[model samples]
Target: MAASAPTLLSTTSRLRVSSAAAFRAATAPLLRGEASEWVVRGEATVQVLGRSVRVRLRKRLRMPATRMEEMRATDVSIERGDNATGVLTVASRVSFFSRSSLELVQMGALRVHAYYDAGANDPAVPAAERRARAGRLSSSSVRVGTVLLPNYELRAGYNELEEQIHFDQSLGV
Candidate 1:
């Protein structure tokens, strides 16, 4: 007779916890009456309590050297699951032309909610802040996401270098 070694179950549980954090990071809603936006990574998934969701984000972008903004189109899709329930497609949506980039934010799941503006809805927005945010989609980036209430987000920066160049060029000229 032979006996097998004990199962190392912590790894599996750790994966579940990690997934929840990542999902929360992906879905941040930028709203303008009906225009919805947020940033996401190449591939992200989430789990909470016993529930889980799968997410994907894709984007296309373009930025001009003269402008501090860019244009981006994103595709989003999500699937959900739970310890007691089966998996299902729980959410999906499209967002376009965002001023922020997920790449800039640090990783690790977080309980976060965010509001953004691609347009100059507020004239008081300082130029430095706007440039830093890449507002107006000046970076030509894209994002995809899935969320479960509470609020979380990821930034899909479109044109990081171009934005930098725009800033540097401005400083020189």
Candidate 2:
């Protein structure tokens, strides 16, 4: 009976240690948060010189950190245009509450230009003008709307240049 008691005690302690390690492993991801990568590619129709032109839009977004009710995407690039490409890099912060889970509020500002290859061949445009053209382009936007997780998102954004609203809803299985 005495030997059996010591063996039972050792087994119980081993089980406790294993359970604690399992608990830590299960909660680590939730506490530390996981980063997600998102890529969006689309085309936008723009009217140029009374003619419609299809411009390719590609955005690579990274959500590096997420908390209980907020998420931050520090690395975001939005590229627009087919000929004279303009790249806009932005950092966005989004917040939401439980009562208004449908309404996700987002604020974003242009961080820098990854590339703006416009008027590079024009000798009439000074070197300084070419470099400053991208610097002069600045925009900040605020958006609000419903964003269903992992599936659909709808939002209206008001920026320095324009107010645009878009929706993305997935259908079928």
Best by TM-score: 2
> Which regions of candidate 1 deviate over 4 angstroms?
1-78, 83-103, 112-173
Tell me the tens digit of each residue's lDDT in model 2 across 56-135.
Answer: 74545342332233222223333322323221223233332222112122322211112223454357879776555532
Clashing pairs in 2: none
TM-score on alpha carbons, each prediction: 0.17, 0.22
Tell me the spans in candidate 2 whose CA falls farther than 4 Å from its real position.
1-32, 69-173
Error of 1 at 27 (Å): 16
What local lDDT score does residue 3 receive in model 2, on the 0 to 100 scale? 23
Worst 10 residues of 2 by lDDT: 164-173
TM-score of 2: 0.22
Q: For all the candidates, what are their Cα RMSDs to the real structure?
A: 20.4, 26.1
lDDT of each: 0.32, 0.32
Superposed Cα deviation of residue 75, candidate 2 (Å): 39
Q: Candidate 1, residues 50-119: lDDT per residue as tens digits?
A: 8888756343222111211333223333344443432223333323333432222333333211224543
